[model samples]
Target: MMAAHGAPWFAGWGTLALVNAGLAQGKNRSGLGWFLLSLLLGPLATLLLVLLPKVRDRMF
Candidate 1:
């Protein structure tokens, strides 16, 4: 768990890079917008990520 949390500095940045790449293909920029917002709003970001329709679709 410690490693997992620490992974965010590098790994999480990588994940965000990939997600940003994917978002770039679309016309709507809100996906990236929300992500940047999350960095400032941690729990809210987690909640927003959790509540996203597309994200939730994949989890279960």
Candidate 2:
């Protein structure tokens, strides 16, 4: 499917992955991990990040 559109398609996907990574970090999550996951899950990953609650900081 993506092959038909070529670089532009993958470029958009890659850009979305980067944006998702930033979103993850903003929520106190691992950006690198989420970026990797985004490569596979794409928009689904973004939906998950948006729906999930932010991690609360703990004083220990």
The TM-score leader among the candidates is 2
lDDT for each of the candidates? 0.52, 0.95
Instruction: Give the poorly placed runs of model 2, Cα more than 4 Å off.
Output: 1-4
Cα deviation of 40, candidate 2, in Å: 0.2
TM per prediction: 0.33, 0.87
Residue range 1-60, candidate 2, lDDT tens digits: 446658888999999999999999999999999999999999999999999999987687
